[model samples]
Target: MIDQLLKMADGPLQDLLSQSGMSGTESTASAIEDTFGSLLKNKAQSGDLSAIKEMFSGSDTSPQSPVIQNLAGDLSSGLMDRLGISSEQAMSLAKTALPLLMNFFNQRINEAPQANEDIMNSVVKALQGGPGSGGADILGSLLGGGKGGGMDLGGLMNMGKGLFK
Candidate 1:
């Protein structure tokens, strides 16, 4: 899923990195993914699933929402510190990427009726430190869980694929 998001964000991420006087798209992509994953994991670990819920709930897509804004701020600060970039450059990258990520989740929720439920369930499990003890399990289960009573993992991947095209 991060791979698909990185592919979809290639052009924009490249532009952001260049503007920040940075190069190496692969590293930048990794940093973005790392920061994003960390944010979710930290929140989940702390029993604060509101952010994850908000992002995947499909109830709101506004980038200005406090939840997304807070996430962007954290991501931007992390990027600035990690990449030695100006706050403006870091914020620019965050502002751009956060919306795209949220949009991706919103799209998935809209595309699959069971997506929100499954995501919520997976997130709850992740918070309980299930399996890998992070959002990885939630994402993995959401994107790789087999067919049963809910939407298949392949269908979820297809929904994500639709975002890039």
Candidate 2:
């Protein structure tokens, strides 16, 4: 699922990186991936379905909520410091890439009912946070079996690495 999301965002992300003069760098790509992964993990840990829904709804024209705004700000600062870009460029990249990424997920969910249910179920399970609390387990189940079978953590990690590459 992470791989699919990253793949979907690759073109637009590349374009954003290019605009910031950080194009074609694997480290930059990895940072972007990490930022996204962190945000999703935080949301899963929080167990707030409505917050997650609002983040990915793709229907909010209003300003981003504080949680998202803070994430974008932090991401921008990190990118700016790491990649030697101006703050404006970094913030622009974050602002642009985040919405694009969310919209991609929204579109995917809307287009596939099974996938939508599976994702929501995974989110709920992650919130439960007991034996199978990790995002890898949730995403692994989504990728492997929709029946909530055993998680392949290694496989999920490898898939995430491959996506960044």
The C-alpha TM-scores of every prediction are 0.65, 0.60
Least accurate 10 contiguous residues by lDDT in model 2 = 127-136
What would the per-residue lDDT of candidate 1 be over residues 45-129, giving only the tens digit for each residue?
A: 7788767787668675687878777888889988888878899988887887777666656665656534575656565554445
Q: Pairing residues by index, what is the TM-score of model 1?
A: 0.65
Q: After aligning candidate 1 to the native by TM-score, how far in Å is the CA of 142 from where it should be?
A: 8.4
Could you tell me how far off, in angstroms, the CA of residue 127 lies in candidate 2 after the best superposition?
Answer: 7.6
Q: Give me the runs in candidate 1 sitting further than 4 Å from their true place.
A: 1-23, 113-115, 131-165
Clashes of 1: 0
Over 120-157, each residue of candidate 2 has an lDDT whose tens digit, in order, gives 56554544443343343655465443345454767566
- Which parts of model 2 are misplaced by more than 4 Å? 1-4, 19-22, 25-27, 48-51, 55-68, 81-86, 115-118, 124-138, 141-165
